[model samples]
Structure formats: structure tokens, C-alpha cells
Target: MLVQVNFLGEASGCYSGGMQSQSSQSNKARRRKEGLPAITPEAICDAAISLTKEKGLEGWSMRDLAAELDAYVRVIYYHVGDRDAVTSLVIERVLSEVAIPSAASGWRAWFDDLLRGLRDVMRRYPGVAKRFALVGPGGHAARAIAETGISLLREAGFGELSVPAFSLLLEQTCQFVAQEDDRDALPSLRKSAASEYAACAGVPGGMGDLSKSVAHATTSESSLRRYYDDSFDFFLRTVLDGLEVRLSNMRG
Candidate 1:
């Protein structure tokens, strides 16, 4: 005499029924075993950031990440939903790494510290710098940085009316830093441009002057660096001076 059992909507009465139900149950068990844990959105985002840093955006893939973490591709769907979510998270994480200095010091000192810290983080991850520039900051880090800037301006005697202008100044400064990061490769770009221009100019007789101008423009690295530094300093000082004037007005 044999007992009967039922599993997975299957009946098991004797040998044959028992074998069939056992097979069904085995299949269900296997499926259950294959399933991954409930990874959170934050964990998925962190994994994406690590992947992006290791392999770059072009090399990143859901399958690759799943394999790396010993997870099924479906597991990613439960957390991130899509590649765009991953990208948004990546930008957020990168920006979060930028530390806002304490408000203990004067506004100028605080701003300088924050900007320098941001610059350092951006330089560490060039891909983030490029991507964030295009995305335009909007997540937690962006909001925090924005609020900090607003507070700094307020402390420096800027009226609520002028907070927007200060925010714009900070944003523009960040944009300038992003643009300057690209300039690290500008010398090579300029060389390639000069070569192309020379090839075209040489084909035409009267374009010799144009070729000279291109060559001259590409030849001077000292001038480019000096100009960059000078322009950056001038812009920063001018903005600070404007803030000072605002503070004076508020004081009076």
C-alpha cells in the first residue's frame, strides 16, 4: 500500500502519479532555487556605478552585471526597471561624492572649498563629468549643492531676490569646470584640426595665409594655459566682487 500526495496542482496516488507529481514539484523547486533575492534600488544603483567606473558606459550591460553578481537578469528589473534608471542613479551617486564644506568659515572660503572638492571628484571620474554635464544636475546632490549655494549667498548678505543669481553663478562655474575637463584633450584635437586645415589649405593657392593662422593658433600651449587660468581667476574674482557689493548694499 502506498500513500498519495498532491503538489503543484498535480495528483500522486501511486507509482506513476507519485513520479509525475514529484517531477512537477522538482521543477517548481528548481525554479524557486533559480530566483534571486530582492535587491533594493540603492544597491542596484551602487552596482551600476561600480560597473560604470570599471567598464565605462559603452561596456556596461545588464547581462554582465547579472553575471558579476550571480543574479538573474530579471533581478535587475525588480530594482532598476531600465537602463535609464541606472543612468540616473549613476549620476546621482557621482554627484553625491562631492562634499559641501562646512559653513563655519566665510562665504568665499566655504564656496572655494566646495568648488575645489567638486573639481577633485569630477576629475576622478571623467565619464561622470561628461555625462553629468549633459544631464544637467537635478538629483539629491544637485539640490543639496544648490541649497548650500543659496545659504552661502544669504549669509554673505544676498537678498532672497539674488539667490537665483548666485545659483546661476555656481552652476555656470560647474559647467566651466566640466568644459575645462574636456580641454585636457584639446591639444590633440587642435593638432588634428591643424593637420586637416593644412591639407585643405595647401590644395588652394591663396589659402596659405589661412594655413599660417591655423598653425599659429595651434602652436601656443603656454598662452592657452595662461589664458585659461587668468580667465578663471578673473571670473571668480569678478563674481566675488559683485557679491561684496551686494553685501555692502545690504549692510547700509
Candidate 2:
């Protein structure tokens, strides 16, 4: 037997509990007459994506999403289940947009290209990069990327270390992106920190070179973003170089 929805209960219900009656025949007919589009999992996921792009993945709640769709909170639960479910769909959608580069570019170059692209995509969605860094990817798109990455490493002589090597490369890149996302979220704190770093360069008996470099990198928005890019590139290249050395050691 199908579950009965208490539409009246929904008006005052908690988001996690009540069933929405929007799927009832009478309500469906009413919605059609009002010209409201039918809600589906895809439509819910699409609205979630829009919310994520505007407010980051962690920023919005189920009520915010319902408001975005002009639907009741229970409607979201009725269609997509819960916040975690919607997040998974949002992650899948974001991952699908990242173009995996051709492996013909060789392992190092392929990763260089792939990581840059991944950063570009993840940065757009804010908290997503941090999620990836913390939990790694979960969906089929992630699996596809991982399969290719591991294959590339194995072919590059990482042998049985391919999985860890791939994990490290991707994790480090995502962590960098995550830091950027965090820093962007607190502009006042960032500016205060930047100001302190800049002041350090002017200290008597100056720490000159190191402090100057830090100050220059942190002093402005454009410089900071460029600093992140340049720093990530340097970090990625250094890891690739170290891995190359490790591969040689394994061979010897």
C-alpha cells in the first residue's frame, strides 16, 4: 500500500518528517492548472546546483532549496530524500563538468593539465573542493577519473604504488583549492592576516626576503589568487619530481 500524505501536517511539519501531498492526483491537477512545472529528482538536483553555485554547497539548507523551487520543504524530501542526497547529486553534476584530459600527454603533463582543470571547476562551487579533499569523490565520474589516473601512474612505473600516488596528487591539489575557498569566505580575516604579514617585512633588522615574498603574495586579492595558482603549480611540480625520483629508486 502507498503512504498517505497529510498535506495539512506538512504546513507546520519539520523538514525531515512529513510527506508532501504534491504527488496526490488532486494536487497534481491543481499544479497543472496553475502552470507549475512538475518536480522530479533532476529538477531538485538542478535547483540544488544553483544554490551551491551561489552560496556554496554547505551554505544552503533544505528550506532554502525549497524556496528556490517555490515548493514546500517536504517536496524536497519527497523527491530527493535529504540534504546529503541532494549534495551527492550536486557533486555528481559538478564532477561531470570537469573535462578529463587525454592521457597521451604523459603522466606528469596529464596531471598538470587535469589538476588545473579540476581546480578551476571545484573553485567555482566553493565548499566542493574541501569535500573532495576530505572525503574524496564518490560517484561514477570520480571513479572514471580515478581509473584513468591510476592507469597513468602504473604505466609511469609507479607499479603497485599507483593508487597512493594518485591519491596524494589529487588530495594535495584539492586541499590547496579548499584552503583558497576557506580564505575567500573570510575576507576580513584574510586582510588582517595579510596586513600583519606585510608589517613583518618592515620590522627592524628585517627578515627581508621571506617576509617580503609573503607580503607581496598576500597583500591584494589579485596577488593572492595568483599566489595560490603559482604556489599550487610549484607544489604539484615538486611532487611530480619527487615521484619521478621515487620511481627511479624502485627501478634500481
Candidate 3:
């Protein structure tokens, strides 16, 4: 004899219990879709990305996205499932726009070019970068980076050992780029934070002080550009040094 557990007033048998909820959800989705305005997943993702850019990831919500796109919140759910799925789709779309370096440039040059492109893209879309960190790597962008890393490692003569390490390195580089990009956007973030903090602190126009602080902290764009160039060069050199050591040992 088997005991049946009641879940949400549904009889829980061996097979019917688990699928009952899923079936109900499917029916609900169908009912909701009847005569609803059609919104594509891509449109939802794009709208979400846009909202993120104007208002940081922390500031974004499904309702905000819906307002930006001039669509119903339910349409977003119908098209993209939920917030997590929408974020994933947004990252995928942005990364897909990145141009992968040609193989003819040789592995080292190719990897450098690829990473630079990634850094540029992340900088251009600071909101996407923030979301990317929380979501971790997924979708076509990750696949493209992995495939390119593997090919580069093979060209550099690392055999199978370099594949996983190279992938990890690429992820680290992305994370670093995201951080650096956020740093550049700190002034705006600080202003936003200050305004919120001021409202909570019962201080009128507290955002002004915060804006000044941000201005003091953020360096000139030219200086930041120089820093970016120096940092990337240092990172590439360090990676190449490690690769060279491994190659030397292998040759030995």
C-alpha cells in the first residue's frame, strides 16, 4: 500500500501527482495567450537590456521593462518565461554582437583581439556586464569564447591540458572587464545611490553631495583609457608567461 500525499489539493499518486502542476501551468499559459498582443522573446530581452542601461541592473524590474517596451508584464512572461531567462537572453544577444577575431591573426594575436572586443562590448553596455556577473557565462557568447580559446591553446601547442585552463582564463578576463567597466560607470551609480540614501537619511538634495564625491573619485576619461591599456597589456603578458613556462616544460 502506498500513501498519497495531497499537494495543493491534488492527489499525489506515482505519476499523476508530479505532472498535475505542470499540466495546470501549461493550461494557464494557453489561456493567458488568448487574444494577447504578441511580443517576441528578442523584443523582451532588448527592452530589458535597454532598461538596464538607463537604470542599473538593481534598478530594473519586469514592470519597468514592460513600461519601456510598452507591453504588458504578462507578455514578458509569455515570451521569456521570467526575469532570469530574460537576463540570460539579454547577455546572449549582446555577446552575439561581438565580432570574433579571425584565425589568420595567429593564436596569440587572435586571443588578444578577441578579448579586446569583449572588453569594448562590456564597456559599451555596463548594465549587461553587471547582470552577466550574477548570471555567469552561458549561451552563444560563452560557446564562441570556449571554442576560440581551445583553438588558440591548440595552436600554442598545449594539447588537451590547455583547454580547461584557457576557458577559466577567459572567464576571469570577462569578469575583470566587467569590473573595470563598472568602475567607469561609478559616478552615475554613486549619484543614484546617494539619492536613495539621502531619501532614507531624511536629507534634502543629498544627491548633490554624492555627485561631488563621485566626481572626485572618478578620474579623467583619458587617464582611465591609459589605465585600461596598461592593465590589459599586463594581463596578456602574464598569461603568455604562464603559457611559455608550460610549453618549455612540455618541450623538455
Number of the top TM-score candidate = 2
- After TM-score superposition, the amount by which residue 224's alpha carbon in candidate 1 deviates from its true location, in angstroms, is 8.9
User: What is candidate 1's lDDT per residue for 1-252, written digit by digit as tens?
Assistant: 132221111122333345545654564466568884445566677677777767664357888877765565655554455565566667777777888788878777777777667766765554566565566655454787777777777766677745675665666666766676667546688678878776765555667777765655556777555655566677777877777776787789
Error of 1 at 113 (Å): 1.0
Candidates arranged by lDDT, highest first: 2, 3, 1
Q: Which regions of candidate 2 deviate over 4 angstroms? A: 1-27, 204-207
TM-score of each: 0.58, 0.86, 0.67
Model 3 gets an lDDT of: 0.65
* Residue-pair clashes per candidate: 0, 0, 0
Error at 197, model 1, angstroms: 12
Q: Against the true structure, candidate 1 has what lDDT?
A: 0.63
Candidates sorted on TM-score, descending: 2, 3, 1
Worst 10 residues of 1 by lDDT: 3-12
Candidate 1 local Cα displacement, residue 106, angstroms: 2.1
Pairs clashing within candidate 3:
none
